[model samples]
Target: MSAPIPNRVHYHKRDRELELGYPDGESYRLPIELLRVYSPSAEVQGHHPSEAVLQTGKRNVGLLNITQTGRYALKLHFDDGHDTGLYTWEYLHDMATHQQAWWENYLTRLERAGASRDSGVIQIHQV
Candidate 1:
């Protein structure tokens, strides 16, 4: 097998999906819902690991636009008005490669915490 080639990539926004393509012919279609829930913005990821917020009710989310951020990342605009995450090329690649595992882990977390991705009260106690 040949080694994977690193090439410039682009993100195309559609109604409900985002298409990512590279010059090396590697491409993937990522659902908007997944992208929204897993956004890398401070609002979603927070400043620290423990401060991360659980995103809810994003099953029907859609991408509104894609803005270039310098030469390293892209800012994704969502129909829900979420446009803070600066998705670096590395981050996007990782998300595409590990999507299934990431989603499964997310679901497991919700189940373990008795939290629903759509609606659930979260109580964070600082010690």
Candidate 2:
């Protein structure tokens, strides 16, 4: 199947959501945090499955800029000093479609590693 082309892209600063509008009267709101965590860069995805890096403390990350990379993708400039991820239309659509499952998986990994999204603040619980 061919990837859907985005007609327009709008970033809502207050909502931290990237609104992607398509020609087929469809739209998707992709959260900034999700984009950051799932960045399609070697720095994040790594060279191999075993080398994939788990991103943390990115719950409040923001998008700084978006540059068109030909007709295929957009280079995402993030506020957290990350500007290497080129977000393709296909990738963005997939992420939006499976956001729930992907987010749940990310949270599960964080829990297993005892990592907090809140600036890596380790919470102490009295047992």
Q: Highest lDDT, which number?
A: 2
Q: Per-residue CA lDDT of candidate 2, range 1-127, in tens?
A: 9689898999998898899999989999999999999899999999888888999999899988988899999888999999998999899999888999989999998888878787858867667
Residue ranges of candidate 2 with Cα displaced over 4 Å:
125-127
Alpha carbon lDDT of residue 103, candidate 2?
91
Task: Please report how far candidate 2 places residue 57 from its true position, in Å.
Answer: 0.4
User: In terms of TM-score, which candidate is strongest?
Assistant: 2
TM-score of candidate 2 against the unseen true structure: 0.94
Candidate 1 lDDT by residue in tens digits, 63-101: 767888887778888888999999887787788888898
Per-candidate local distance difference test? 0.75, 0.90
Candidate 1 colliding pairs: none
Which regions in candidate 1 have their CA more than 4 angstroms from the true location?
1-15, 117-127
TM-score of each: 0.78, 0.94
